[model samples]
Target: MTLHPIESGNFKLDGGAMFGVVPKSLWTRTNPADANNMIDMAARCLLIEDGDRLILIDTGMGDKQSEKFFGYYYMWGDHSLDASLAKAGFHRDDITDVFLTHLHFDHCGGCIINNPNGNGYLPAFKNAKFWTNENHWNWAVNPNAREKASFLKENILPMQDSGQLNFIKKTTKDSFQTSSELDFGIFFADGHTEKQMIPRIDYKGKTLVFAADLLPTAGHIPLPYVMGYDTRPLLTLDEKAQFLNEAADHNHYIFLEHDAHNEIITVQHTDKGVRLKDTYTFNQLFK
Candidate 1:
């Protein structure tokens, strides 16, 4: 099995919102803010080529939103979903499965796109099945007031409407194997959302966990560095503490999603609790 890091695009978000209650004096050291106080963020997704199945972890924000709509997020960079797929020697049609960690626009917006005439929407990955759990699907479609803005109907709905949406069965087990050689398990964390599924994959004798929003960047390694967007901040503390302990003990590599600079990182149990041990790009890992 081969894993590829797909660079979709970059955008800027308020550093304060990204870091939550954490003081700017602390987070700024790792993720510096611009004059407008927006921090650089990448919509980095993962692509797994295992035998006949090419699985994409998350689809970054697509370019379908209006300029006024995108103005809110300050989208930047030339990287695009289609361009990234081409670099990997694949196309959207080659993707057999699209495993979404969550339904936030920035994470799954690339799932659908405007049709040829630009009159309606269509599934971006014409032949692939969109994977999202039942709980998250329900939570997203019927979003609460706090998260309503992040879950846009244009970025979603089309998959279900296109008859390509599939739900992973809920299981009590922490991890389970999929139908391919790229077998992976799911780690559900509620602090971030109702049932945010973090894919834990066993690859090349090492375990790689897609950090998703749970640990957005190396700066978020500390237990208290939780995102302010999390609905349950207190619960996030416990989730991070437990996940970090296990990640450190097992020497698992974390694949960061929103970290524009750092792609992957490992943690070690220090006196101050789990801390960043090392950072690497996708190519550096094999070297």
Candidate 2:
């Protein structure tokens, strides 16, 4: 099995929003903010090539939203899904599966695109079966007030409407849900959303985790550095603590999706809990 770290795109999010109640003085050390208080973030997705199945985890924010809509989040960077895929020697059509960690716009927006002739939206990876759990699907379709903004309909409904949407049955095995469909185990964390699935893939003797919002960046290594967007901050505290401990103990490598600067990282149990031990580019370790 070969893994490709896909750089879908990059954007800026408010450092305060990204760091939650954590004061700027602390988070700034790792994730320095710009003049506007926006911190750099990357819509970094992962692509796994195993046999004939090319599985993509999380589609970054697509290029469909209106200028005004995208103005909210300061979009920057030259990287794109197509360009990244080409660099990795593949295309969207080659993807046989798309496992979404969650339904947030930045995470799943690239799932759909404006059809030819500039009309209605359609699935970007028409050949791939979109994956999301039943609980997350229901929660996203019927979103709460706090999460409605993040769960854009255009980025989501098209998957189900296209008849390509599929659910990953959560076969609870130990702490994670084992899915025979993909080569990874998913650990569901409700703190970030209804059921954000964090993929744990064993590749080349190292356990690589797709640290979605559960651990967005190295700056979020601290237990209290939860995102303001998280529906349940307190729940995040518990879930993150457990995950970090396990990652540190098992020497698992974390594939950060939103950290623009740090791509992959590993944490160690420090006096202050699990702290970022080292960081690596995808090629540095994966190669």
| lDDT agreement with native, every candidate | 0.90, 0.93
Residue pair clashes in candidate 2: none
Alpha carbon lDDT at 79, candidate 1: 90
- Determine which window of 10 residues in candidate 2 has minimal summed lDDT: 170-179
User: Residue-wise lDDT of candidate 1 within 75-111, one digit each (tens)?
Assistant: 8878988999999899999999999999999999999
Measured with C-alpha atoms, the lDDT of residue 13 in candidate 1 is: 92
Worst 10 residues of 1 by lDDT: 173-182
Q: TM-score for each prediction?
A: 0.96, 0.98
Scored by Cα lDDT, where does model 1 land?
Answer: 0.90
Candidate 1, residue 246: Cα displacement in angstroms equals: 0.9
lDDT of 2 at 82: 98
Candidate 2 global lDDT? 0.93
